[model samples]
Target: MKTVILRSQALQGATASDLSAAVQYLIGVDGGGTGTRVRLSDRDGVLLGQGESGPSALGQGAEQAWRHIQQAVQAAAAQAGLGELDLSRCAIGLGLSGTGVEAQVEAFSALQPGYALVALDNDGFTTLLGAHGGEPGAVVAAGTGTIGEGLRRNGERAYISGWGWVCGDEGSGAWLGLKAMRHAQQALDGRAEAGALARAVWAVAGQDRATILAWCAAAGQHGYASLAPLVFDHAPNDPVAAGFVADAVSELERLAHALDPQAELPLALCGSIALRLSSEFSGTIRARCVSPRGDSAEGALHLVRSALQR
Candidate 1:
């Protein structure tokens, strides 16, 4: 793969007359573990319509995910009043979670003929691009998992965390949820004092300790991670919940430190959980970041536009 480097300002201004002229339709898709989102825009970047579907990416299986993407694009196009839009003349931008892997890439490549021009990359890459307005910068992503990436002024790159939920992702929603569950179990078993964390878990899983245990036994890391919002909701008056937040912030800070301690540039806090905790976590992460200019959908569009220009 060839690396495409552009000045931050230049990247933001990228366009393609050829692609634009052929584009009676344009679609940007952001496919992740949680779900998929589609955005339709005109040649000039005017928003036309949007749609959503369940997770879509090769890692989730090519046929199934592609079906979802097809449905989403069709819905968006229909809403945009371009019901019979030709895929052959459409410019497509896909930010897909699993496509970075070789097998996944091959699967995506096999499906490329479905559209005029298609660009596929890991969803995180596009998220960073959109968060920074196509600028060279960094992002800390804390959702079901945690990861950080940076693009230096010289076009070099650095990364931290993102080892996955079990061994890494220390500050992620899955981590926090796991901690909360452990605390709850410990409290029930008389190994620890019953605290706010226990109460929060019980409230979400039900009041019975046995029910909570059963839920934990059946659920995977992602299921546990789903409880993070409950933890945050209880944090204001709950010391244990507050501690979880503190620890999450500390882990995020570690990720930031691993990138460049002294380097001062825009850092974006992305992903569902990170976006929610930005105010609290920003202080812990040291260098403050700017609000995301857009989400991964916009970033996918930005990348597609840049690629066409090149």
Candidate 2:
């Protein structure tokens, strides 16, 4: 019996023609801390189906993540008119949040799914691939959590922020919400000036200190992000919200600037809040921003095809 060395041997050495003949389907997954989506296509890249499910981000339980992915795959197959989908005939590509962490990456690599082959990478890379259509450019992902990613013509890659909800991910939904909560707390204590945004946060998070504190203990990134919309809605008339937006824009600028220090490369603003925040960019980033060519799922598929062809 031979012991399989997956760490060194996975996703290596398969000819294009060989894989093309052996593989009947391709599945691309875009997974984040909040949700997971799956897109299915045939060997030739014609779209077949798509599906979405719960969160599959890293650090979450591996079984939970795989389970949601499996469910999403099944949903896609059903939408593709297949009553019975065989995983062994399908190849998969996944771009997942938190996979940048070495331990998280290693944990996922150890898994043996029934797919013919699998390619896994951090979600930001796929975001960059999708935004730029595989070209050399950068993307500032402003969503539940923010991150900046880029690829140079020479294949040099860079990532900034995305340190998660607590300390980093500046200008992200969670960041805004966290700031809003802080303002709300301060308002209650009379320690800082409160405005319409802070008042709104108080209404949503409960009016009392004890109640707000309890909610904070139970709240996660999503909960924090849910408050961002309120802040955005009130930003026009609310000084506090306006301040939050200003800070967020500056942080995003920092992220984009780090990738293209000279602010020369084409940049795309992506994720849930990209368009909303785009108008706030103060520097060259505003002009450098380009529309995304596709999305993360498409990039995942593209990566799969690229790998197979290699």
Candidate 3:
């Protein structure tokens, strides 16, 4: 069996041994629009295994999220050499996307699988918890979606962005992809120059107006997000792609500013898009960014541990 090692500082000094003896396992789940990732550990915080599965974003559906989470948990159990996990003997913590919606949260919580204990929060908050090891700081996570959260010294918390892809989540992969599609549409109409970005988007979205319309009809958040890599790949040579990257960087910077207007809290950039665009950030913001101590999954573990202590 493969052994997993997590960042030591984040996992140190937090022994879940004091939890109920019946709680033999600690499972941390980080679920987003892109996928669900699970980190399995013994109660004592020893890493056991890690597993990943398809999207578990609550916006996708509460039932679908649970199914994906269960699949990931089972995979983690198998990787740990455990035949099957006993939910009743485990405590689970989840950091998931779309937890901002009260109805979705309620729906997902209603389906809890009999775990001994549970703690849940949006992925942005969990990312903040992990980035700072539960300290006062801020994080802007830009992946399939985008969110900014900050913890102040007075125990106050602030959230910025994270409005989801339909109307918000600027600087996200899906947002980038949406912008790329717009560029392609304009190019196809001859309203804009047909550059490399337009050509690439057309290749995936279809070359003709009818086919493009058909593609857009079915291109949900995830489908549109699938085109984000093209933007990144062409940014080096394509002005349109480069402009999108510039806009994304600015959007993320705005999130940081909104999260901590005073800019006092340490800031950590999380998620694939955030990391990829980090270097492109303005010098001031770049200087303020710090590497995260852990990730959302680890923060979920911390969440349940705190819950158990209370």
- Best model per lDDT: 3
Best by TM-score: 3
Better of 2 and 3 by lDDT: 3
Q: What would you estimate as the lDDT of candidate 3?
A: 0.87
How good is model 1 by TM-score? Answer: 0.81
| Model 2 bad stretches (over 4 Å) | 1-17
The global C-alpha lDDT for each of the candidates, from Candidate 1 onward, is: 0.74, 0.81, 0.87
The TM-score between candidate 3 and the true structure equals 0.92
The estimated TM-scores of all candidates read: 0.81, 0.91, 0.92
- TM-score of model 2 vs. true structure: 0.91
Residue 238 in candidate 2, Cα distance off native in Å:
1.2
Model 3 agreement with the true structure over 1-310: per-residue lDDT tens digits: 0111221232234465534565788988899998999999997999999999999999999999999999999999999999799787788888888888888887887787677777888888878888899999999999999999888999888888989998999999999999999999999999999999999999898999999999999988898889899999999999989999999999999889888888898899999999999888888888788999999999888877776665
| lDDT of candidate 1 over 225-280, digit per residue (tens) | 88888789878888888888888887887787777676576888898888777777
Where does candidate 1 stray beyond 4 Å?
Answer: 1-22, 57-59, 111-113, 203-222, 282-287
